[model samples]
Target: MTNVLVLGANGKIAKLATAQLLANPDNHLTLFLRNSKRLANAASDRVKVVEGDAASEADLKAVMADADIVYANLAGSIEAEAKAVVAAMDASGLKRLIWISTLGIYDEVPGNFGKWNHQMLDGGYLETYGAAAKTIEDSDLDYTIIRPAWLSNNDEVAYETTQKGEAFKGTEVSRKSIAALVAKLVADPSQAIHESLGVNKPNTDGDKPAWY
Candidate 1:
């Protein structure tokens, strides 16, 4: 079985992804988190949890050892943490990385929408995300980056996917949908290798679908 290490394990999206991963039989997943308290119910006989900051080399090394794939579904100072993760991955000889990024990484949305999103995240944050993405893109290992449109709390999964360089159409998309997509990426690595895209419901009406 392929062993997977999911960084940012305590987050909401990570929780959904973790549940999906647990349901699968061919893989074993380890949840690496900074705080285990927030992840109380996110456990099972097949699921393992490791506590540590993703930015620390020692913690990363402990978790990265024997890990076949890394899923980086994180928030907060993710850029710096991503750098640390890359370093640790390199040290451990682990290659595959799947990062959940935000929309507008390529300035796909324009005018107030893009401006608002960028402004809210700050220019420095934008640069950081970009730099982090570029780092993985330029690295020798295989990588997949997924950027979802305005995340929602809906409990549904939709097969909406957008091509790179296209504007993110939907006004909102479910966080669970994004998490489900992340789970899919973890299961099948070859679908969108070395590319980033936006996800949203397919309906013309701007509404986020609930994740089932």
Candidate 2:
């Protein structure tokens, strides 16, 4: 059985990914978040909901005991959280991490879209997220960093990926697509190790997301 620890379980994409992960009977999940009450109803024999801050290495280590894979979908003070995760995983002798990051962290988006992306994400967001990705990459753990383009709430799961250093494609992608990709990775842990993927919907390229 694959024991998965999902940090930020209350996140929209994490919740979607939880459903997908649970579909595989061999996969067991420990949902970790700051507020356990938020996911009180999701607990089951295969699912364990626990409350804890991702920024606390002690809290993370406690949940890391039985986790074979760590999927982190976090926001706010992300760099500190990343550090805590890495330290805790190292302490627990755990590897294999899947991190959810945002697009434009590498400045690889091209054309007006690239410029527009900076206008939208500059200041603090991109910087801290980039730092977080760096922390994961610098670690000895086998890790896959997922960088998603502008997100939409669309129900569709169609999407594509660009590797690190490649110009990011399209302008937007569905949250469901990201969740699907996360599930795919969990199913095949060896895939995309040490790779950073930029996910987007095909042919949606524009200076900005359609809704913007």
Candidate 3:
């Protein structure tokens, strides 16, 4: 049985990924979040809910015990949270990690698409996101940093990936697609170790996110 630790468990993508993981009875899950009350119903025979801040090493270390893999779905000051996660993982000797970042963090989008993204976010978002990516890259852990394009609630799993340094393609992807990818990686943690990927739906290319 694979023991999965999910940080930011209340996040939309994390919640979907949790359901995907739970579909397989062999997978056991431990959920960590700042407010467990939001998902009080998630507790089950194979699931444990722990409420705490991801930036707290004590909180993370307490739940990191016996975990086989770590999947973090976080936002806001990701740089600081990334640092905390890396420290906790190192302390527990856990190497596998899947972190969710956002597209354009590395200026991977080309031409007008890239320009619009920067203009829309006004730089600060990219600064924090990029810092978080840098932290994971510099760490000793085996990690896959996922940079997803503008997300949609389309309920579909059609998507493609671009390796780091490649121009990010398309402008939107469904949340379900992101969750599917996370579930796949958690099941086989070595698939994309030490790589950063940009995920988006095929044929959805646009100057900006479709919803905008």
What lDDT score belongs to each candidate, Candidate 1 first?
A: 0.78, 0.97, 0.92
Candidate 1 ranges with C-alpha deviation above 4 Å: 204-212
Q: lDDT tens string, model 3, 32-133?
A: 999999888989989999899998888899999889999999876688899999999999999999999999888789978889989987558888989999
Better of 1 and 3 by TM-score: 3
Candidate 2 local lDDT, residue 120? 89
lDDT of 2 by residue, 1-212 (tens): 99999999999999999999999999999999999999999999999999999999999999999999999999998999999999999999999999999999999999999999999899999999999999999999999999999999999999999999999999999999999999999999999999999999999999999999
**TM values, all candidates:** 0.88, 0.99, 0.98
Q: Highest TM-score: which candidate? A: 2
Give me the displacement of residue 88 in model 3, in angstroms.
Answer: 0.5
Among these predictions, the greatest lDDT belongs to 2
Please state the error at residue 51 of candidate 2 in Å. Answer: 0.5
Those runs of model 2 whose alpha carbons end farther than 4 Å from true positions after fitting are none
Evaluate model 2: give its TM-score. Answer: 0.99
Candidate 2 residue 26 C-alpha distance from true site, Å: 0.6
Write the candidate numbers in order of decreasing TM-score: 2, 3, 1
Q: Write the per-residue lDDT of candidate 1 for residues 126-206, one digit (tens) a residue.
A: 677777777777777678888777777778887487777777766567888888887787788776877777776666333
